[model samples]
Target: MPGFPRRLTSRAAAGLALLPALTILLVAHLGSTSWTIWISLTSSRMLPNSNFVGLRQYETLLNNDRWLVSAQNLAVFGTLMVVGSLLVGLLLAIAIDQRLRVENTLRSIFLYPFSMSFVVTGLAWQWMLNPTHGIQKLVRGWGFETFQFDWIVRQETVIYTLVFAGIWHAAGLVMAIMLAGLRGIDEEIWKASRVDGIPAWRTYVSIVIPMLGASFATAGILLSASVVRLYDLAVAMTNGGPGLASEVPAKFVMDHLFERGNLGLAAAAATSMLVTVVSIAAPLLYARSRARTAETRR
Candidate 1:
């Protein structure tokens, strides 16, 4: 018999290597998602039942006040968290990159929060923001009788507290991304800009930002995914308290799944979220594909 061709042997080895990953992906991720979609169409109770209910679950979910509020909260939280984390993180990265003293120490200090479980950090934030025990009480003890930082207890502003802690936890990741991008910049660009008498701010705004597009894209995508799946921090900190002002979509789905025992509704909410994500992402993806095609043609 003729020996196997080298290319055929290489292909067979590659296929073998991919088999485990493909199996896991098919069983765990794709299989679960398909199950979710199917269950959404069924009248599943506490556990998944086989009774088909058509689009009734979707209709019920659409009519749910709590689900609607959760979606709204998610929108607000996602917007604020993404924008705030990116801006602050970029600034922090730039400052640290300036050859400052104790750069590693400062970097570690900022990144430490990311390593912590939200259970610990969120409780700490809750304590710090508590009206009777936290910043307000400390300030009152300092002789200022009217210093009020009680937004944490208010229905209107409690979501902002989530944004604050979310930013604290997330900014480090963004900073790391930006720092990597900044380090990859050609040193000669800085030298040339300096010799041209361009201000540091101008150079960063016009030159550095444009070149760091890949880094920003990476950070933005990561942050957006986190925003969509926000639950742990909210649970640990506010528990969707102050009249559901801090509720988010992930929490809504989880609540319906486990707490409310409405798997059908839960699946409906999850499906809605998936639709929203696709709606937003589709245009961006199309634009990217077009850009890549144009670049190739050029």
Candidate 2:
């Protein structure tokens, strides 16, 4: 009984400290999500209402050509962006892990882009990819008249350009994460691999990569979240132009909500995105948790 008052006081203080976060989670996040889901099922347009249309908006969304194009573009962008960023970042991390003389400088330079906003990255890439004054023009000026690098203005290739920008912006963050993971590996592992006549590349591919599962998962989740909310870069770079070639789900939702005044459609799109993210994330999270539990037991 003597320690009960102190324990009670400590518990009360901890709960009190968590009150604001709990309020925000319940009201700001869960409440907003519930309301959005409700609105998506309605016939509301330009404003919220109690119309209760029952999945009509989602049906329309599926049938819409622009929405379909946007969805397809998102798949392309997300796949290429995530893969490219991971590959490029891993290579960079591996290079730096070799104890180069300019490791710090290289890291700062690589990470500098990630520090800049996506808006800035988009604008920079846009300028660099512009046909009139960008790479094509510059190359033409260098006597390469027939060299064409104008992917941004072409419908089929505009999404790829966005992927390039996304990778450039995200690769550094992934590199940093992987570098930390690499540094955490035991020196004995490297020595053992060398003693067993394993090539350095083989060691990295077989042993080191498997050991950096946590780092890879962390970077992947972050990249996937960015993919789901990919709006600013698309807006700043192409503005979903080139005949909606670069349009993504988030941009489509925004255009419907604000520009088109279609609240129901916007909410439906947003809900679909949420569901997709949750579905992908749920399995990964469950597997990770189970792995951790198994490790603890072992």
Candidate 3:
């Protein structure tokens, strides 16, 4: 007993060690969120003020055409990016899981893009997608003079281009997630499928994918967060250009908060984003918790 460490003492010491970090997080992040929410309810513009004008900013934000466009753009981008990334990532993971001779090399190449900053990814994709000196020109030079790959410059298609770049950047991360899930799968599943005359694709589609719920959830959460704060990619690639065609909510908030000196509107937009994320996430988290509780009872 003399040589043993007391559990209460250890726990107390750990809590004490974490106290500073916990305090900082509460003050910095929580305080900032509360402040933003409060600001959104007020008439603050160009600077903070105590003048309370509740919901005015929200009403204005709802009416703003640019804001509506940004929301629509985000909706399109989020849907396409998430679906495309998941599909491409799953395919890549399945391919790499085949235990090819160059599996590691291929995985490294696939995951390399995720390691790069969004700015770098955006710029690289931008240069490659540029109409004048990029793919279109290169293809035209090769004899197909009418080949049109100028999506980046078209207002209707620029957002799709962003989605493409986003998928290219995020698919590797999703692949890494899916690959881990694939590897954790029991080998017997494969043997059983082979014996039962089930194709590998069918096994993956029905059984393997269903079993990888946690992996999919984890990847979805990460990708969803990226989708919410999509700023740098849009900035570096299109700068919300071709007449606000590729504008996203984050960029709208940034432009209002910084460039346009509309702090109240920006805060409202930020608060709306926060509320939307919470609205979606809270239910999922609650359901997950309920499921775990039921499992425990069983």
Clashing pairs in 2: none
Residue 39 CA error for candidate 1 (Å)?
1.2
- Ten consecutive residues with minimal summed lDDT in candidate 1? 1-10
User: Each prediction's Cα lDDT score?
Assistant: 0.91, 0.95, 0.95
Q: Residue 228 error for model 2, in Å?
A: 0.6
Candidate 1 lDDT at 167 equals 93
For model 1 the local lDDT of residue 89 reads: 94
Q: How do the residues 1-298 of candidate 1 rate in per-residue lDDT, one tens digit apiece?
A: 4556977899999999999999999999899888999999999989999899899999998898888888888888899999999999999999998988998899989888889887787899999999999999999999999999998889899999999998999899899999999999999999999999999999999999899988888999998988898898889999999888888889999998999899999998898899899999999889988998999999
Pitting candidate 1 against candidate 3, the one with the higher lDDT is 3
In candidate 2 the C-alpha lDDT for residue 202 amounts to 99
lDDT per residue as tens, model 2, 1-298: 7999999999999999999999999999999999999999999999899999898999999999999999999999999999999999999999999999999999999998999999999999999999999999999999999999989999989999999999999999999999999999999999999999999999999999999988998999899889988999999999999988889999999999999999999999999988988998899899999999999999
